[model samples]
Target: MAKLTDEEMMKMMESADNAVTGEGPATMAESNDGIAPLTVRKLMIIGCGDGGCNIATAIARKIPDETFVIAYNTSKRNVNEIVCDMKVYVTSDADEKIVDGSGKSRAYSKDAFKLNAYKNLLETVNIGLEKMPDISYIIVCTTTDGGTGSGSSPMVAKLLSDNIDVPVLLMGVYPSMDEDAIAQYNALEWQSEVERIGVPYFVLDNNQHGMEKPKVHAAVNNQGAMIASLLAGREFGNSSISIIDNRNLYMLLVQMGGRLVAAIDDARPSSGQTLDDYVMAMLQKNYQPEPSNVKGIGVFIKGSRELLDKMDTSIPEVQKKYGNAVLRFAHIENSDSVEIAVLLTGCSEAAPRLLEMKNRYDDIVHAQKEAASVIGDVMSGMKNLLGDPRSSKRRGEAKEPDISALDL
Candidate 1:
């Protein structure tokens, strides 16, 4: 395709602006130059549990026509409550005979998926495909600390990755330590399974969000929706400054075992703030203790040409800081204000948290084994003291006189 000129780009943005303000159609009409207008990419959002469903619902609400959303859970009630294009209730024979929660058992959830959920998923995918035949991406959302979400997510992601032609993205929410020990264990196990499945995933740490349960849920959903919007939104402009298409996004995000982080700066430029200073400040506010193992960086800037020019100079500093990591850039002209979105891909700093959870899980298992051993020893001692009636009878040493004297 030919590069777009600055004037053309500005017109496209104006069209988008008009669309957003409801003054005109959201999509641009075909230009006289024979250039087709930008269209939102179709997405399939498969939510695995309550958390996933919540995020999916938020995304659906924001981009109802662009996405097909579905929720799957072992709990019929939970699945019933989610608002989505479809709901898939996963169940096993045991679940059908005696309905109960997975009791936070990752094993139970995995079994349910292996025995029953996969079929439902296939059917759901068929229906979704009928609605959105041109779907370009699949996003699997789940919390990695619960039975239904943690256990089934990896399997679901793997199935989609293997069967579908499009790239699959995993949006995983890590559990807070305060939730439950089982949750920690589940997260640890789920991480290993996800790694083995080898799908790219984004982690949202519930512990670090610093919100109450309800607020955290909303925050997470909003963040997920924002990321989805960024990926799906058009990055084209008239100028050949930089653009991130769906392929660019997929390449940046599909690095196996990489954690994704996005930082956004929406504040007005202060009197003394340079574009570089603003970008650095945004990074500081969003990224905690810089990741040393960074592998890729994507920078999206929406600002005036002057600010973008300033950003051009700062790119070298970013490259220097990240060392040899790959970098991608996109610039969109917006006269109202400047904004930056930074996406980083690398080995996550969540290793320490995972290790801690693993250690705690090991400690619990050890303690349980020790307790069982102690209880077994005490029971054995009591049995020895009482003597074995069967052994006594076999040895012809059984006694029968003591009860007769008292009864008659």
Candidate 2:
């Protein structure tokens, strides 16, 4: 046996897709009729800015064929090579020259959206909605540290909230500790604005999972894709207990209305592995704070028949940890490993890093103000105090450190 190459794997997947669609006769278990053939619920994603668009592309690959992932970006260079269901350019016709990027300035992206990109963006979104009217959920993803994502995502989310009846979620990618002050400041500011918009949102911190840039990027995108796959529900298998539909996703992410922390764990079939263990694992893996005023929580566990039969559906361990919160649990069939996903909302106020950023921003402002007040005329004040450079007093004698002992 030999391992398949990327191209080989892709061709196999394409052939399987063709088989499912009647390009050839369908023989797969999933292709068989009768069992409702997986969760039919669909979820749409709109990714804004560089980071968001990249994640969207990754998500598009992971989701089912009918589901669409749309990317919105200002730079042609940013999204040209990216592969997604649709790409909408955020443009400004008024500008004499075409700007390829937001230049790390959120204001630029926001102004462009408000000025010229508004109509096009809204129209394109409506068109997508019309094409996929069955979409139950809409997730708007963006990189909070970048100019375009930080500036444009809030307005985009708000626009969707105002016009569409569907539940919309904003997924903002947070900057890592190693990122520069500008990126940190942009991320911090964007977080504040998104929260104020009153849209239920989640921030995917870039600092965790990996240290290197590419690793961190992949980790965040992969985590987001997993959330999408779980929320949309699988396209095959019957539930041993209750099936988690898009409505559950809505109850936790949208109706809850605050920051979200979602995690998924693989529970291999074993005597020791319990549903409680799976939920606890997810809790441990969550990037956000532990659920404190959790308005709502949705837990979905999928596994084979044997696994589901053996599993204890009770979530006492979770309730004991999170206090009183709306907890919804569902266990469906997956045919593969026992998979579990938990979504917790209403932890926005407990983010410590955002508080640290606010303090840091205030300190910077205060220091600048203090420095400005004192330095009415810096060089002139120094000259007046020292008299003239020609005077002996103006030139102070150097006092060197006695390093003769250290030199030895």
**Residue 252, candidate 1: how far off, in angstroms?**
1.4
What are the lDDT figures for the candidates, one per model? 0.67, 0.68
Candidate 2 weakest ten by summed lDDT: 19-28
lDDT of 2 at 289: 42
Models, CA RMSD each: 8.8, 13.8
RMSD of 2: 13.8
TM-score of every prediction relative to native: 0.73, 0.74
Over 29-124, each residue of candidate 2 has an lDDT whose tens digit, in order, gives 333334333455677788888889877877788885646777788888865656666777765576534458887899989888887676777787
Error of model 2, residue 250, in angstroms: 2.8
Off by over 4 Å in 1: 1-39, 93-100, 234-240, 255-257, 271-292, 313-323, 346-349, 359-408
Q: Summarize candidate 1's per-residue lDDT along 1-408 as a digit string, tens digits.
A: 133356754554454334323344222344455544442588899988777788788888877877899888777666555769888876556646423557688888888888877887978887898888988778899888888888889999999888877778888887765666788878888888887877777777676445688776776677778777666663323223344444335545773236666656567767766655665676555422344455555666667766665554224465466443443434345454555676666545557767767777777778889998997887874646677765655545666657766776
Candidate achieving the largest TM-score: 2
